[model samples]
Target: MVTNEQSVAGPAAEQQGFLHQVKSFGRPFWAANVMELIERWAYYGVRAVLSLYIVDAVANGGLEFTHVQKGSIYAAWAMVQSLLPLFTGGYADRYGYKGTVAFSILIKIVGYLLMATQHSYGGFFLGCMLLATGTAVFKPGVQGIIANANLGNKASVAWGIFYAMVNVGGFIGPWAAGYLRMMSWAHVFYANAALVALNFIILLMFKEPERPAFEGKRPSPVTEFVGILFSSVKNVFEPRLAAFLVLFSGYWLMFNQLFDLLPNFIDDWVDTSGTLAWLGKTLGNPTMLQNGLAGGQIQPEWMINIDAGAIVFLMVPIAALFSRMKPIHSIILGILVSTIGIVLSGSTMVGAYCMLGIFIFAIGEMMASPKKLEYLAAIAPKDKMGLYMGYANVPNAIGWGIGSSLGGHMYQTYADKTTLAKAYMADKLHMTPEAIAAIPKNQVMETLAAQLGQTPRQVTEMLFAMHHPEHIWLVFGAIGIASMVGLIAYNAVVTRLPKPATV
Candidate 1:
């Protein structure tokens, strides 16, 4: 039998465990997490397949746009979505979070509908812009709720759980999209719209946390928005923070390729027959064997889902482990690991290696991504956490915008299968440029095969031998390595600087 003192101590000890910290989070915190889950579900559903959809042959129900065009759209999308939060965070603080969230949901629904209906480049671009704007507005409000949730010492646990919720949505979105797109591409957009619409219901149920009150007379809404914009910009110039964000951008530049470019890379180059066979036999699911590709290959979205799945299952424990280290050290280590992952993933045509690389990258992402936000939150003035959180996205905007543009151009010139096939037809087959251009993009490989009296696989191998598309990954890997170096240097300089004296 336990002593009375021991019994009391056991119960007290249980109260300090991980489950207790999770259970202790307030209603507002949980509500914010739920909203984030739904929002990410909708956003990532589209993102999971966007690259393939953009460049797919028109005959195959894709837009048939060039890689460069897709990159431009992504560049603009990144800037609008990531940069606008710099102001929207301020707006969330001045206005109510509930109102901003509700407004953003409505805007996102409309954006999804537009994307579903409009097939033209201009029409689709407008839809993406609308979605970006809605996301930009949505982030700061939800993050602000998390910031002011009164988490105290449990902030790391809270943020880690919130990030896990994000990956839950991220995982589900692509997994669903892989099957949904098999039916119709439009279904993906329609489903995302419905998912976003669900957030409105969530907003109705949750209470917004109390916001910090403004001093003296309240300014007009327009005046407040402008003031926040200017003030947010001013804060970015803080030497240490500014240097940190700039260096961190290189990580995002490499990070975005996993989603934006890798899908197409896998589709065009990597052989997934081995993995697909294993998945089919193990799961015994008919759908696993039903992707439209010849040889029943795995869909690219399913491959990319590995990243999200890894995070959903593993992020919290990883966050807990890294929480003990300084945030900058964790970030630097993460970037280095992630760089290795990217290089490994891109350097191979073997599907198993690619999957392993993605898993490795996910590990690095777990270590780095959450710490960036937590570091900002820790250093922020309590009342200004929302604004600072908004600033947290600046590196994403800069890196993704530049990376998409450059990565797109690189893919088009260096690695695009169709472009390579066209060059082969002209150089070896003696086909005129006009004849090559006239072939439907979807059928170009088949046409080349027929002309050369070779199977499609043989021609693909020949092109691979002639033009090594794997080099594109090396470029992206270098960016990640560079960023890691920059962060390490920044941390050293900042650590050496004398601290301001206490009064």
Candidate 2:
């Protein structure tokens, strides 16, 4: 049996410089990183604009689904994407990473095409499920490759570099999507499909990492699947790991909002004309000043892109800084910082402040996200690295599914401008529900503005003043604080427990 020290690193590696250690990770590692980059690019490209596409008025090229419907789709998406990995990870280990990856690529391609062609709610939901499933399968295969390739003590550095590559795609995908969607939303989906296909070529460039052989005759597929499911459940329920995952779910609940809810929030309330005008003047580019909105507002994707952009440039150093610290400590610190960022981002309509908050949140993300994977990888048994890594997604699944459902309800109740507008017409104008129903849902705000003898921006400001929509951030931020506190307590308890005996 290979010792933990040997599995992690050779003594000779300790003598090498950091750059040399990085280079030593070799071809398979780099190839996996590239594949990760491409995959993230494809996923985020669609994701960056999905909320808008789902909830925007049909006249404006969106599906015009209610916030509640959008939430249901996202909640289901989280379940399929995050939970399926629990089993797929074992499959990758038992079969081969290469075959799983190839299968996922095809699944993802079909998903993108469905999204592009099918605009109905049921059709689009199916598309998203397919995409999520493909992503679920894809994650463990690539992560397993990384686990096998990083045969050194610089695991933190290796994961950080991999994360930075993830942001490279994250940053670029949204930037491109911001422009592509201007032409047409269909263009964005098609573009992502093409980008995902590039991974097929990347798959050919790397050899599969060696996997452990089964000692006995392999079980039938049905038996093996059941065994994997039972084993995964048992492993997750181990008290220490279970406590950590449950606490970590709160962080993910808050983390996912930056993507799932914030885009709609920005679109409905935040005014970005000032930022757009500033950029256009600063860059001497006229195109930056126009977005078909009344005041030439900055696109929501560009605003949210701040999070990915900050990580792309800063993740490595931040990871290195926290490399020697206990993973739990880093995570606690990150959650605290992130809570502040979330509240700040959501508390106002000022575009610059929103961007600043996103940037701060990115710092917290840099500190926390990679460490979660590193911590899980460290504790996993040598032979079950892929299975354990699959387990790493559990927190995200729980958090995202719950958060999406709750956040959708929250937005619908407390913050939806159209809903508020309809209410305003009912209470203030003494308009009946039937009268309000006569107006197009997309044009409710415009109609409200006309009735009040105000511009759309003026009506939006009035609604903000009367309704206080920004309070939603406080609610989500509180979840992060609770998570941070839970993690701290869990860490204390774990630290007091006895360490396992080294063989």
Best candidate, lDDT-wise?
A: 2
Assess each prediction's global lDDT (C-alpha) against the native: 0.82, 0.83
In the range 365-479, model 1's lDDT, one tens digit per residue, is 8788767766666556678776676677788888999999999999999999999999999998899988988999989999999988998878887898889999999999999
Cα deviation of 285, candidate 1, in Å: 6.0
Candidate 1: regions farther than 4 A off:
1-30, 144-160, 206-209, 282-294, 377-387, 500-503
Candidates in order, TM-scores: namely 0.90, 0.90
Clashes of each: 0, 0
Backbone clash pairs for candidate 1 read: none
Worst 10 residues of 1 by lDDT: 1-10
